[model samples]
Target: MTAVMEPGMDAVETDAASSPYQGYVYAYPHKTAYRPLPDRPGLRGLWAGEPQRALSLYIHIPFCEIRCGFCNLFTRIGSPEGLTTAYLDALDRQATAVRAALDGDARFSVAAFGGGTPTYLTAAELTRLFDIAEQRMGADLRAVPLSVEASPDTATADRLAVLAERGTTRLSLGVQSFLDEEARSAVRPQKRAAVEEALGRVRAAGFPVLNIDLIYGIDGQTVASWLRSLDAALAWQPEELYLYPLYVRPLTGLGRRGAEDAGHDPAWDAQRLTLYRAGRDHLLAAGYRQVSMRMFRRTDAPDTGGGDHSCQTDGMVGLGCGARSYTSRLHYSFDYAVDARQVRGIIDDYVATTDFTRAEVGRHLTGDEPRRRHLLQSLLQADGLELAGYRQRFGSTPAEDFPAELAAFAARGWLAEGDADRLALTPEGLAHADAVGPALFSAAVRADMAAYELK
Candidate 1:
């Protein structure tokens, strides 16, 4: 199985859109088996020729004190016997292997630590992880956008100082909802005061960016209550705010308990829209700008205008189990088993070499692979690919490649043509992004179906 053909390949499949070599659509193996699995359209390649200077890296720490019912992230409740320490050791090994694979003096422009809670690591573990990153990837430890995800409970002043010392400028605090009842129903026990304290400490530590993660349409979440939460978040004035509407996953506790009623459905969806509209208005009024579907920022950050292209365009190297990495033409991710033995096995594989074979790439990105790639790239920033950049990389025009779909989206006010090189999704598009994100998976799923047939 060779790489998928670009427009120039004469062997282009006539029914590429309908091709059978799509990506896997099952639940990400490491996440909660209790929630419904979200659609994941995989990528085409794995090993890019060589590492580039503008790369990004995301490291996952899949450990949490208590697993939230709504969370599908790979995590376990306070694994004893020092599993966290073991995971850190495993991560350092994986980093070394990844460095070997990268093959050159590669420097990363952005690095983000996301997980059950990266702050769960002890200060020593965190420092060691950063040391591995600095030594291996030559990552710009002093970059402006170095971000990490932390829960309120784990984000102590000590942790803030540790992060600041490590050149971490951004902190994404998971606040979920301000309502205590809503928080309890969602199984997130962190108190609102804790979130505020964490934010205050991080800001006082001089971290440049503070982003809060908020959710609307949770069980017992009414529009009025949702507005109050927003008001509370606004009072803190985080540098950025990311809003997510809760989606039910069949494999999560919420799913087993039929938790869709918590934050999904048209009515809940409408409430979220109202929240966004009001929230966007409020943020913009407060002088913040919309950058992506769920992202808004203060004027200080680069005017990506809501698009965080650095992650997608340059590609990212992910550390930690169940983390996904993307390169110029490939996306690779490994699963982490919750059980101790499986965790060790996966970690061993990480330390060992990973040969992303042609068959694997074929299974992820083939058939209508290019278009799906285009969509993912565009959606990341709520803006379409730069035409010149796209041509330089993928060698085709999206309008020419997916004429009907693009035209239909534009007609429905979900998309708009930007400069010849740019395509930006409209406000309408942002409102229904969740649904459309799955549409982008069409090609991936179709390819998966084809693969299933072959099997």
Candidate 2:
């Protein structure tokens, strides 16, 4: 059993040695807020230079059975079935548009159906989606690992079979916490039997991997309770586990129930770290490899091994509304704008000419104003840069361009030297990857922030 520190005491000190605020850390301003930047004219040059095939697809079905309190997905709550019907058609049309843009290239390494819950769709709806995706992209749905996100309530046996038949090898079940009280308090009221039944059904259906997501650091959750949740979750034998630390976001339900409002411990931040460390230790002992900061997988699991699963870095092509694609040429995202009228417009655009482009690609990628582009990709994953790859892509070496920055990280025990090619990040570096990227591009971020302040 995990032990909880006393209520009045500090679980861990927030001094310079242990806090996240230390170091010559760079902070990245929100990339989402910037207006579409001008497109680069030499995108074709970048594509020809980097002929890496699109390895994955992320299709966002933004409709949930019920909106969870902490969820920030781009979804509409309690949307009518008629709206869903319309949305499915839009998804197919959108896929055609994207495929047309790809110029008939359809071989993707992985495809993920993520959302509020892809299983929210009826069997027929899902089948139709798969059929359309295959037809348009010439996608080998059967060959690649297809992952679908679902909740316990929707992962019924029949639905699992339907998904299995549709070539989905992976299922991501959102089981935030096993403790009923904690789950309910967090507004994710999951039933024990339902979770069990769903896991059994999905596993029985021969899903290659069953990943269960768990949340720790919720208010009223102690180390003991969190451990109990972990124990119960392990009992289910999930192939992978994703543990996330809860953070407050503006306008979220949990955010409004602030630390001050919740009459409990010394402070929320103090409790958060304790729960995080405890959960990490427990999962590590249970033979789960910490794949990323918030993700873990069984060490011996064949399908979902210790590697990056997020589409952002893995050459993924996104379909459906609000789905984003990071290609060799440019990064493009589609949103079925919130209004039904805007949705109709996007659908019409898709039907009229099966392809489209946006100006954001140019704005984000173009122009050589001595751009100090941060290595957001390397920073997000603990994976170190291929020094040769960097030089070949940008025609500059890290040591030559930013020696002081590299030295600063090395001084902090976060950097490890590699043989003439890779400058690796140690485990400590992985834990704080998000913070390091900003420092790498400090000049650009600071200038952007300063501009924001002036405005």
Candidate 3:
């Protein structure tokens, strides 16, 4: 499929047509665009006028048992003596300050614990983390849909018990592959037996949703192996599944090993696309519905409801050094890095910090950025964007605001034919979600991301 670029469109739209796996667009104006806030605006002032009724709460833990080859996340391997304790102490302090800043008006509609791995902590430590969220941040986990991430090794029975007892609605386990060789090839060393045991334990704990995450395009992975992994996960009858395409990014172990060459290889792209379609079809045939490019939910899965918290408009309060907080106009966080040494340094600085009242590093959303964010986040979902909602929010339709981009997408056959009420992606468009997403990035954001210096 060829994407004919409209005269005024950015070059990224052209690149999107050729390279379908450019990058994952999980969030707009990613952390790479953030800069030091010289004025260090107070958190209270940032949240004063922002709506807090349906806020989302997030807590980040930066320690992991081992670093995977394809990982470029801001995390370190292993917590040294007293490191976890100090980190928790800092988390508590930050939560206290942020809660005070919200001025007693905030109410969380959903919450999440993500990281390196939230379950890397001991069962008792998990209890303490929950207490801090409930006590200091005033997030009632029991009342909200609480999601947590876990790894196969850390999803122990005790940890699962603690998570279930504390009202965790979803537990997402990173089981990249069911085959041990493929797991090792991806630098995630785990046996199939252990993964199965962990899955059994998670099911026994009775969480509302069990999400198994698998990665396609791993070294030596073929269509058959990918299906095997998918079938293995299906055998467990998980409520959700996330199939991620392997990305060998700079600063990650795979990048250091020169594995990034495969990312640019046309043959590799074809292989990944083939594998993605096979897996997508298999899941759809097995009674799972596509939620996004990466997420698939079982048709009969229990709905853990928190529909009020909209990522495009709702405010989010993030605690922990690795977490990012979002208000209507600004997104803020502490320093971010993928290098091990730099990550440890940031964590140490976070632990030793006393005050948490001001925004240190962030980007302020301005003008059309909010509209772009709303459009980008909404369009990527399988449900697509409601034109009426967009018009109601911005007083302009997407067609009026983004005619050229929409035309370019239509040229590439990435857009679905829809009535005036909705705009959505075609199946091929969802397959190339990474490409479609980056193409929509604003020019200023792209420049900011490009200029970021990696540590």
Name the best candidate (by TM-score). 3
Per-candidate local distance difference test:
0.61, 0.59, 0.87
Highest lDDT model number: 3
Distance from true position, residue 263, model 3, in Å?
2.0
What is the alpha-carbon RMSD of candidate 1 to the true structure?
Answer: 8.2
lDDT of 2 by residue, 425-445 (tens): 777765554345545544443
Question: Candidate 1: misplaced stretches above 4 Å?
Answer: 1-48, 260-264, 300-309, 336-364, 417-421, 444-455
- For model 2, the stretches where C-alpha displacement exceeds 4 angstroms are 1-31, 34-52, 258-267, 304-315, 335-363, 367-374, 402-405, 417-421, 437-455
Poorest lDDT segment (10 consecutive residues) of candidate 2: 1-10
Reference-based TM-score of each model: 0.80, 0.78, 0.96
Candidate 3 global CA lDDT score:
0.87
lDDT ranking, high to low: 3, 1, 2
Q: What is the C-alpha lDDT profile of model 3 across 234-322, one tens digit per residue? A: 99999999988888777778878977566778989999999999999999999999989988999999989974899988988899998
